[model samples]
Target: MFAIVFILLLFSTGDSILIGKIQNSTIIDVTHISLFNITLNQCICKLITVSGIIPAANYFPGNQSCQLFNFNNNSSLISSNFNTYWIFTNQSSAFITNTSITSTSSPTTSISSSSTTTSTTTSSTTSLSTTSTSTTTSSSTTTTTGCTNLGMFPYQSTYSVGVSPQSVAVVDVNSDNKPDIIVANFGSNTVGVLLNVGNGTFLSQTNYSVGSAPESVAVVDVNSDNKPDIIVANTLSTNVGVLLNTGNGIFRNQTTYAVGTQPWSVTVSDVNNDNKPDIIVANFGSNTVSVLLNAGNGTFLTQTTYTVGTSPMSVAVVDVNSDNKPDIIVANSLSNNVGVLLNTGSGTFLGQVTYITGTNPKSVGIVDVNNDTKPDIIVANYANTISVLLNRGNGTFLNATTYLIGLSPLSVAVVDVNSDNYPDITVANSLSNAVGVLLNT
Candidate 1:
């Protein structure tokens, strides 16, 4: 009977492969994703194949209800819960039943065949373990299984990444629809560049060696030549390096100029209010931020140096404390604060605001974490937690929520993982070896 159910489900999608389904939250392994269909609204979907079987259809009933279904080997219908009870059914018998419990439930089911189908679910902001599935079969035998969820009240879930990654700056030097990743390795002396392979996966193209170390990297048309250029802050080098992107990944005419001691971060902004992008370098070795006026050519002239706080590691240009012009926010790593530099609208700094944050900060990124119109600050700290600072738009940060994440997070990159119109965080944990992803609710 299980063999028949497996064959039917596998044949339903016109694929001859085994498929598996998750009842409630229980995960089963399938060999392929070709056998099941997935349908969901507002909830994220994840598909895993096990033992040569694919996953069954995933249906999101609504914001408050979710059901994972699959047919068992005995042609029984299986159901798992989002809020209440759990039950497993074969065409003729009940295998497992937990009626007294009242919580979200999950079950797993599987079958064997050949061929494949693909489907996806919407991403949520809740925490869920990563699911894996695989399937295997022999020439003479077949197997089928089912999982079910039976529950009461179901609510939409919010998913968070394991480590919050922010500070993603995309640029296509090759005119590809995809963007390349220029990561500023703060502690490491190299800048990691990952090329987009048109597909969803990113390939590490090359790592450029910069002096001392790099904190942040920005790509822009510095010469108005239509091609992008790379700007990196050599923290210990106490200078900024410009590498003009040469159609290929190789950079030429590498130029280095003094800005300040321990230049920790850099940003390209139109400081003169003339629409021409300018350069701002935050110095950590020195308590100052340097502004360089763009010469229209590929070179820059030092404009002025403004004193900031202690150990500024990150810089951002935003119109906070709005006065029609953009302001500068520097994440002071050692000071445990973010320094806001109010713009004078005339290429000068007027005043500054200091917002207290968590300890031993490494990097910072801005996003609308609470769905508010104003941007919030997500700080990745070496202290092992992420600090979410709500921007008041008046140069002040409201109460911050620090989320405990991976160990020794060095940087952050924010992107939409499931295309939910909301942003998620990805963290590059230096010591952890693997990148951690956090989905925002």
Candidate 2:
């Protein structure tokens, strides 16, 4: 019984050459192979095993078998009843194969000789059977290593609230160190409180009845009692509701104070520098921001209305010019811009300076996004984007960078949710019926 083995080396022109072969050798090592020629073409080497004789005559046939073997510098010869042949090529031919021939006691061998006469070369060849295997291993390693730096921010969880949660405020309502959430549920005509139970989770929400169609809620220590109270903007009732914190996650009956028509949002700050917290309301129907001076005992003086852009939907207080006086920033939904009302150290506001933003900007939040020590403005535009305006530190803002958010983003809040020290954004997506959290990179 005779078995035939065939080995084929195919390459593009000038890529590879068959230098020579060593025949009838008992032991073969890396030192026994030599390169005789060189080529300029880039080489690609592949080793494929074909069983039985092939149709081409270039491969040796009849009782000759080729087996895959690796040649290393420290390899030792294994005793076998076979003959070994080694072939060497140039540097471009990095792949090699070894053939073991089994024959009768005496075997006749023939050698085909060809002379180039142009150059003579001498270099050792090492069988690279594992070269292709190592290359594939490296490719797989690179693919997995590249994914480590692509940080992804996925939703942690969503806690269901009342119908149509239009606004949200994060505070410690029960004096717990963990931050709690208060939502103005417009459709339910109530304020919902979700106590934080730690680890980015919330307990079942508790609701308190307020005036009709509560659009916004703010937590503040209104009575100087060291306990945070809840203030709500009742849109349909055209009033502001003040709920005194009665301790232990409970609130007293809401005290309604009449403000401009269709009050949409409320913020608590010391607008007059009287060391007492005052309430500011954004009136959507009247196109004004109403300031209610705190009377120091859970009561507010008569509301004073200031003219702003059309349909003032949200309000924020900050020292826009670094003058130590709190200035007001309003997001005008109908005007498609933000109105900056600089405070004059008294209770009066200067004429409004408007900075254009995305269409139908609904809510605004202030944060130092660029680490420049000046607060920037982030607005949630109902036109399906979030606008970011960098502050120039002198009560004015530059052009906006708009990012596509969830459908119908009605409100936005900035907080560092991932502990990365950078501010992340949370938007109340009214149309999508979900809260969208965008983690800062």
How close is every model to the real structure, measured as TM-score?
0.58, 0.58
| Candidate 2 per-residue lDDT over residues 29-111, each given as its tens digit | 22211111211110001111122211111112221211122332222332122343344433234332353333323323332
Q: Write the per-residue lDDT of candidate 1 for residues 329-389, one digit (tens) a residue.
A: 7788888877778888888887567777778777888777666667777888888878888
What lDDT is reached at residue 105 by model 1? 21
Alpha-carbon shift of residue 16 in model 2 (angstroms): 38
How many clashing pairs does model 1 include?
Answer: 75
**In model 2, where do residues sit more than 4 Å from their true spots?**
1-163, 176-181, 193-207, 401-407, 414-441
Candidate 2 at 78: error in angstroms?
44
Top-lDDT structure, candidate number:
2
Q: How many residue pairs clash in each candidate?
A: 75, 0
**CA displacement after TM-score superposition, residue 254 of candidate 2 (Å):** 1.1
Candidate 1 structure lDDT: 0.61
